[model samples]
Each structure stands twice: as structure tokens, then as C-alpha cells.
Target: MEIDLAGYDGVIVSPGVPLNRHPIAAHARAAGVPVIGDIELFAQARSELPAHKVVGITGTNGKSTTTALIHHILKTAGVPTLMGGNIGLPILSRDPLPEGGVYVLELSSYQIDLTFSLDCDVAVLTNITPDHLDRYDGLEGYAASKARLFAMQSPDHVALVDFQAEADHAVLDMAPDGLGCLFLDDVPVEGQENWPALQGPHNRQNAACAIATCRILGLEDDAIEQGLRTYPGLPHRMERVAEKDGVLFVNDSKATNATATAPALAAYPLIHWILGGRPKTDDLDDCAPHFDHVVAGYTIGEAGPMFARILKDAGKTVTESGTLRQAVRDAAAAAKPGEVVMLSPACASFDQFTDYEARGEAFRAAVEAL
Candidate 1:
């Protein structure tokens, strides 16, 4: 599938394309082709348009939602914006924007790896966690991949950082002193109480990041508030599916790791947690703190038995529901009033389904049948 990029101005590689492990990097470097990501393409293309801006977001979690939110805000304020990068559509596939447009890019570590000359007008790092360790050597290597987002930025650009945890502190410390980085922790999350869809501490941090980014972009205070209030959240991430017979069904299928799923468990008081798939990292140590919220644990997919054993040892009532359909049905039948039947699998979806979206759709269908 290798094509000659000698004639092309720049090679727009897919986010899934692992330049670090793939031959594309060597090919482009040898061909004298500027191997750029979709974000880079969008940033370069925006220069020709009048008053167009670029907002780049990268993190271990919340990257998709934050990018979508930023686009939603700008779009709400009568500014045209396009969202692409790791959240999917290749940036080159779309046409260049006109005046007053903003390009909101959801960047992954892989995409950042390919981009060399991108200087985002507003760059954001939500938070860094140990993810894609196989792609990188270890946690430090993984952290280094995330750091490239800020590292590639120019001194004049703004960096919005969610420095809420120690890991975030480490990433921030790596930045040059007096680099004009804005801390999302300093922003008041107390103000966005009216936005129901953006509840929970995780979303609060996301909101703060978006607010700081928008403010830096010179968005008026009233426009920022309006944008935050009207922004609709992305699906499959803390989405409220349905409420049947006093039981709330939440689809957090996007939580493919323990750290990502931990926030969902913290948001609910009583949860009949539907977890387990092809396991990612070893141990559910990050999720252990939220064990008190689990009323029962419904394990599914290949890792079902392993998860069941772990939950059983933790003294949580566990069921070995091998499939998502079975897990949903069993949880629905056993869940009591005022309990949440949450699908926060804490693992990747490749074991049984193509992706989290397929798993989530199965959960929805199963709930509808019940």
C-alpha cells in the first residue's frame, strides 16, 4: 500500500499509522517528503484562511470529548470549525476553511509522532496516564509521546494543561520554565453547575480545559459560558442510555483501561458494573478505590473468568456473564431500584467486537430487550 509521495506536497498519514514502528517514517524521510499528521495539514491549511484558528488536544483520556466540545463551542458562537485527527476523518480529505473558522483536532501519540512542524494556536494536554505501553517502551516513553504535543508548540502559542494529579504535574514539570502554560486546575469548575451533561469531576476538568482554551482564543466571557451550556456531549463516554424500572443504564464503553473507567464508577453511588474484555494493563488497581460503588460485577468476554476471580476476591458479588448481551440481561434482572447498570469495560474491545461502539450497541440492544 505504499505510494510515492515525491509528487505530493506533504504526506497526510492516518492516525492509526504507527510511524514509530512502521516503514512510512523511513520512506517519507528518504523521499524528502514532509510526513505530517492530519493536525499538521489542518494547521498549515488554516494559514491561508482569514482569522482561522487551530486547537489541538492530546491526552491519555478525554481527548475525543474535549476536542468535540471545543468544536461545539466555536460552532455555537457562529464560527465555522472542523474536528478531525485521531477522532477519525483524515484532515486532507476535507476542504480548507474560510475566514473565522477554527480547526479542532483530537491528536493521538501516533499522530503527534508524525507531525514535526505543527504549531497549534491553542494546544491542550488533558492529562497523561500509562497507555499504549506496547507501542512505547514504558511509562516514561508513553509520557514522552504525550509531551511531544507541547514540545512542538511555539513560544507564542498557549498550552492548556489539566494539572489535577501527580502524573499531570510530571508532564507540566517537563515543560520549559515560564512557558506560559495555563493550569486547568486554577479554573473554577464550580461555575458550570448548570451543564448536566458535563457533570462529574472528569468532565469538570475537561470543561476547565475547554474554557481556558476558548478564553485564550479571545472568545468573550458570555460566548464561553453560552458555549459550555449548549455543548452536547459525545456518545459512548458517560452517556445515559435509558432508565427502566428505576435502573439507570449508562454506556461508558470508551473506558478501555482502568484509569479511564475509574471516573465513571466514581460518578455513580450504586453500580451493577459490566466489565471485562481483552484485558489491557495488569490488575484493576486504579479501579479498586471505587469498589464501594459496585453493587454487583458482571464479567464478560475472554477476560470474564479472570475478572470474576478478582472481583470475588475483592468481596464484590460477581457473575460470569461471558457475552455483552448476557451481561446486560443478568445485570438488569438482578439490579435493584436506584442502581446504575453501567458498561465500563476497563479493557480493549478487540476480544469480542470490532470496537467499543459495537459493544455499546450490543448493550443498548440487550437493554431494550429487557
Candidate 2:
């Protein structure tokens, strides 16, 4: 719906709204209304309020969990904080903060594209990967969009980067040379041993980024540790769905690409992996390194046959389970003791479901039935 924000403060929209390709951009431009994202709206509203802070997080993955962890830490320390943007409620929908509140925003590339003047107190880039490439022209264009978050900030802002790969390195290499960039590799990953939910190398990177962000925000070390220990992981993203008959069921439906799903595959061994959907890119070659972990593959959705062919050629056992329900049942039946039935579809969900959440729910329900 087109909003008449004339004389009103501003209009807040879902980060998924493609302003560059959507009518909202033209309408807002014609109305002289600055096309600000939810994060920008939150930043603007914070001005009239008491002393509040914002931590903006953007990356190809781990954004939701990192944002939640930051908010969890702040709340554990008795600081009022809200987690919003791509993680939870729309930023503008929340009631105004009273005083000394913190806003942890999980920003997507589209949101960052719309946001121009938002100066986050703590800005973070988890890692950049080949994602949403159709929206941008190529990988460089996509990285450029992610880079805009740090660019919009002032020299005083702090950036947490998880330089995962050469692509991430290339993105960080263009960081204006003098910006305050905290590399996750430089952070000590030792303290996170106490946090089980934050397991795996990806979560370690996430923990390091969150710790750096909280530390930059002046959060005490004790409080940060407490938050890390108590933080519950986000749903549908590396969530432990069920364990039946000695087999573990992992619902990493949020992994819509090879880079995102690769970490989960690396986390486990002997996986009866359920993958395939509306394929994101041409190849799953990035995930090939983890092929030793996959004992059998259950393919589903539009890319089922294609993935089956790919796996078959790779000498991996494969089944073209056309639906999520069938895929789950087949994988469950085929899985043995000490094996993992993981739903890490390295593709988008639009082929058979509204989104990844629905696809994940369907996987859970199917798993429950088995």
C-alpha cells in the first residue's frame, strides 16, 4: 500500500521491498519523502528520545542470530534493548525507547540500499558472499551494496568484519584504508567454548563479531559472556528440529545458498542431506568440499532432478524426492544410527513455498510424522 506520509514523520517498510524495482521508490521520490528503510526510521526516531544506541548488522548470513545475541546480552545486563529489522518486528512498529535503550538491527542488502543517512553507533558486516546477484549485476555489485553500510557511517563508527573468504577480503580491501575494521580472525575464539549453542566455526565468527560489537558499545565483559551463554538461537537457522532413533534432524532451511549451507554441512558428519529447491545459482560446486559428509541426498522442488543429476555424477547416492514431505520421509527411513537428516536446501523456497520459514515448517512437520 502506498502511504501518504505528507506531514507525517516517515514511512517504514519491509526490507524485502525492492525500492529500485518497486513503485514505492518513485512514489516516495515524487512526494519528496526520503526513501528511508526501517533502520533509518529507527535512527530518526531515536533523536527525539533519550540516550539510545543502535548496532546495525549486515551480512550474507548469521545476521539474525548475531542481532538476537546482541539484544540478549544487553537485556541480560539490565539495559533495555529491541531487536528488529530483518530479525523481528519492524523498527517503527515498536514503542519508542525511554532512555539508554539499544536497537540491534539485522539489515539486508535491500534495506542498506534504501538507507542513506543512518549512522549506526556500531555497524557490522558479518561476511559477504554471492547472494541476491540477480538484484545486483554481479558479485562485485552485491558486495558494493553490502559495503554501503560502512560507507554511510562516520569515521567514529566501528565495523566488525568476518573476513571469511577472498570475496570478503576483496570487499574489506576497499574499506577506504583508514576505517576501524575489526577482523574476526584477529579476535580470540577461546572464550566461546562455554557456549554450546554457538558451536561451529561460523557461530564462533558470529560470537566474535557480537562480542566486538558489544565491547564497542561499552558492554562489560561479564555481561557479554552472560549473554553469549544465555542466548537462544534463531528459529529455522541451524535449529535442531528433532532426534529420532539415534538420528539427528537439523533444520537449516535458512541456508538458501551454498555458502550459507556449507558451514552446517561442515558441522556434521554422515549426513543424509535433504537439499534442492528453486536453485539460486548454476552450480553447487562450492558445497562439493563437504561431500564426504553426505551419505545420501534427498532432492526436492524445482531443482530436484538437476541436483540429483549433479550428485549422481559426483558419485554420491541420490534420491529425487520431489516434495519436502517425501524428501523428509525418505531421508528418515534411509538414515542410520549416528547419522544426520539435515534439510539444508541450498536454494530459494519460492518454487514450492512462500518462504524458507514455511519450507522449514513443512520439513519439521514431515519429520514429526516419521
Candidate 3:
């Protein structure tokens, strides 16, 4: 990681690099070289690529789904599109799209912090919540980082923000005039019921944001609807893995935190909720409202005992299963007809698995085994 920063325009780093404390950032700063991310690199190269619109989506949760959904809609309408940024591939790694194409990017707050000049044609803020507190000053600082995506856009461009879950009005203030406010309830329930991948109130907002972004991109309603109906959905985020004897198995391993897991819990009525992992927060305050939806809880990984105690205190039946496989088996065995055996752990998978994707694959494998 040692290199002279002479004659370099800027040091490009991944979103995970904490510029606030990383020595690389300090070295780059001392060398008078700015540290930027892939999104900024893509912004600089935009003029070289053929005429194409960019959609930048940022928030604590649902950004990935919204980004993928928008990409799916554009493709469904026969428009050439590529999804990158914080989701799949780095923006600079992918081949440039042809004319009339759209680049849908799921930007994290960290990426947005390092990105300076990405003026997205359509920018969406799904919703803001407390996350990555160690990276920024606090929740306000984190929210400000997300707000920069819209601030980088032009006045003529469209900015879509989810007003329903917006914790700070200041984020809306940072948006350009003629802002498009998306409310989850505004998205017709009947329309969403048909979208299997996009279930739960949170996905409703994700769908709403995608719909607004697609409409701004000049997509017809029919094409947008078709895309919503046919979005295969991203892995580990509300993915319907399998079904056994009328019991559905869902893999929501990307939750990683209670804020992300809360919506997944709300998606199913009778859930044998399997949760826990490397602990992020001591309390599941965000998920408390949906306690009634859980038929019982199976806890595992580092936070197993803690979550078991919490669920028990909340008057919900709890199983202190110490492993993902055991939690799956316990939930599956206890699950009755018309119940959902969901793996929506509200913590990171580092305690037992390499990452959330690996945890999700394990959940899928465990369900397949059943």
C-alpha cells in the first residue's frame, strides 16, 4: 500500500475505505492528491461514453433493490442499461453502454462521500436511518453524505425521495426544486400484491422509487409495470428460496441489521423468525412493532442468547439455536402449513459465515435439504 502520490490526479479507493481514519487518506491528503471512489471516476468518464442517463440511488436500506428494479425496467422497455456502483460491479470496470442507455447505480453513503461530481439525471433517496455510525460524525453527518447525491444534480434533473421514511427534513431541503416525493402507501397495494419479489412495506417504497425513476427516464407505464412484475429480485434480500409442504422459505441474509430485518418480518404474517449473528445493536427496537407477526423466534450466532432473551421479554416464543443450520431446522420443523420459515438475521454474518451472500446461500442450501 506504499506508493509515491506524485503526478497522480487522485487516489481511487473503494467505498469501504474510511477516509476519516485511514492512513491512505492521510497520505493522499498530505500529497495534495484527492481520494475518490469509482462513482467519481465514472462521472469524469461520462463525456467519453455515448449519450446515456445515470440514475444514482442512495439510502441506508433498499437502495440495491431500487437500483436493480430501475435497471430491470429500462431493460424491459428495450433500453440498454447497466447496473453498477455499490451493488454488483464497480462502475469503471463495466463496459460502457451504447447510446440511449441508462446507468443505474446503487450508491452507499461512503461512496457518495468520495464522489464529488456525479450529477445523476434521476437521483433517488430510498430512506435514511442510522447506520455506519463509526464512519461518520453521527446520524446527521451520515444523512448529509447521502444528500450530496441530489446536491450534485442539476436543477432540471429529477430527484426522488421517500417522504414516508425520511427521518430528516433537511435531506428534502438539499434536494433540487420540483422534487418527486414517494410515499409507500401511495403505491397501490393491488399492484404490489402481484409483485412477488417486492413484498413488505419497505419493498413497496423501493418499487415506488423505481417507478418514479423509470417514469422520469420516459418509460411507459406498461413497460414499468411489466418490469415490476418480472424483476427476479436480488439474492439474500427477501428472496423466496423454496417451499415445503405449503411452508415458504425466504432468505433475507442481506438484512445485516434490525432496520433492514424489520421490513422482512412485516412481509409475512405467520413467520418462524430466524434471527441473530454478529451483534450490531443490543435492542431490536426497530423490529418490535412486528412482534405479533412472528409465530416464534429462532436465534443463532453471536447474538443468539441476547435475541432469545429479547424475544422472550416481548412475550414471543424463542428458540436459542446457536447455528444457522440448527435455526433453519428448528424453524422448519416447527413451521406449520401457510407459515413462512424465514432467515432474516438482524446482524452481520461475520460470526459464522464469510459474508451475507454466503449466509444466504447456506439458508438456501438448508431449505433445499429440507
The models' CA-based lDDT, in order, is 0.82, 0.82, 0.87
Candidate 2, after superposition: displacement of residue 51 in Å?
1.3
Runs of candidate 1 exceeding 4 Å displacement: 1-12, 27-33, 134-142, 151-154, 164-179, 191-193, 220-223
Worst 10 residues of 3 by lDDT: 181-190
Q: Judged by lDDT, which candidate is best? A: 3
Better of 1 and 3 by TM-score: 3
Question: Candidate 2: minimum summed lDDT over ten consecutive residues — where?
Answer: 165-174
Candidate 3 stretches with Cα past 4 Å from truth are 1-7, 23-32, 164-169, 172-190
Off by over 4 Å in 2: 1-33, 133-144, 163-180, 191-194
For residues 1-370, could you state the per-residue lDDT of candidate 2 as single tens digits? 6667566545567667766588877777777777666667656666687888788998887788889888888899988898888868788788877688888898999888778777777888887767888788798888888877777776767777766643444655544446677777788756666884676778988898888888888888988999898876778887878889999898999999877888888878799999999998878888999898899999998888988988999999998989999998899899999998999999999999999999999988988888
Estimated TM-score for each candidate: 0.85, 0.82, 0.90
Q: Note the residue pairs that clash in candidate 3.
A: none
Residue 192 displacement (Å), model 2: 5.0
lDDT of 1 by residue, 1-370 (tens): 8777676677777667766678877887878988776566655655566777788899888888899888888888877888888775767687777877788888888888777767777889888767778787788877777777777677777788766533444665555455678777788765667775676778888888888888888788788888888876778888888999999899989889888899998888899999999998768999999899999999998778888888999999999989999999999999988999999999999999999999888888888898
- The TM-score of candidate 2 is 0.82
The collision pairs in model 1 are none
- The better candidate by TM-score, 2 or 3, is 3
lDDT of 3 by residue, 1-370 (tens): 5788977899988788878888998788879998998889889989999999999898877888889999988888899999998888777788889999999999988889998899899888888777899998898888888888878888778777767445554776676686555544455534998998999888888888887778778988899999999998899889999889999999999999898899999998999999999999999999999999999999999999999999999999998989989988999999999999999999999999999999999999888887
